[model samples]
Target: MNKILLGGLAALALVAGIAPAAAQTVEFTVINNSSYDLHYFYTTPSNEDHWGDDLLGDSGVLEAGYQATATIGDGSDQCLYDFKFVMDNGAELIEPEIDICQLSSYTIND
Candidate 1:
């Protein structure tokens, strides 16, 4: 039965080697320094077809000179996303393929 024992040990080692690394969540802040209030903030997985719901829900508009903490991490193991800022006058600026884990904050200014 030594062959069986060796096979089991090898299987265990392979499983350990293929196990995923530790999870991480990046908490970043969004600062609004422009002249208009931030009406909505959107974020979605970089690979998705649509943007998720407004990240600023219920917190009200983010006025100029204010900041909000935007936590960026996927429980589904995604690490990249697109971020968008919508202003009060229906203008929007989008930054695509943002590695949210690499940012501490973002600013929208004139």
Candidate 2:
């Protein structure tokens, strides 16, 4: 993982207001070990018809060999979610029915 991401995680772990283990918010780490840079990350509740938005934002990029934390707090208390990882070359990887409540991290690997 990149130093920036690791440092951010360390700082976030120190901050107050982080949700407790029983909170509805699902906080998990995303590891990018694939060959391509990750351009965008999208997550939506399993019951939703549409993906809400790119969590990585417009300019944010998760380069290969890097990792980032994703927090899903839609206020719905949903545990199951669908994830989309878009690569820099326009390739997309979709993972469905992930129970974020039970996961600490997700890895995208070749």
Candidate 3:
């Protein structure tokens, strides 16, 4: 992840009013350990059916063995969120109730 993404996360956290010492310190690290390069990253409310904007925006690329980290919400207090990782080949992995608060990192295994 680049400094631009980190700066964006900081802004998001502040807008959401997440305390500095809380879960906001921990980032959601998306790992692409598969053979394919993941192109899009989405995180939305667990109950929502539609995937929200790409979390990666213009910096959306998690190559094999690499990880991209982003802080999505306020300490939020809510633990559930959906994650979608998509590849160029039209393959995708969607995970629900990711418990973003408790997870230090999330991995998409081979």
Per-structure clash totals for the candidates: 0, 0, 0
Per-residue lDDT of 1-110 in model 3, one digit per residue for the tens? 45655555556556556455554434667777888877777877786677766766666566788776776753434578888888868798888888876888888886
User: Ten residues in a row with the worst lDDT in model 1?
Assistant: 1-10
Candidate that scores best on lDDT: 2
Q: In model 3, how large is the Cα lDDT of residue 90?
A: 77
lDDT of 3 at 56: 63
Query: Which residue pairs collide, candidate 2?
Result: none
Candidate 1 per-residue lDDT over residues 1-110, each given as its tens digit? 22432343344344434445654555677788899988777888888878866656544577877776665433435667888888889999998988776788888997
Q: What's the lDDT for candidate 1?
A: 0.68
Instruction: List the pairs of residues colliding in candidate 1.
Output: none
Q: Note the Cα lDDT for every prediction shown.
A: 0.68, 0.76, 0.69
Q: Which prediction has the highest TM-score against the true structure? A: 2
How displaced is residue 73 in candidate 3, in Å? 2.1
Candidate 3 residue pairs that clash: none
TM-score for all predictions?
0.71, 0.78, 0.72
lDDT tens per residue, model 2, 49-75: 899667665556789988888666555
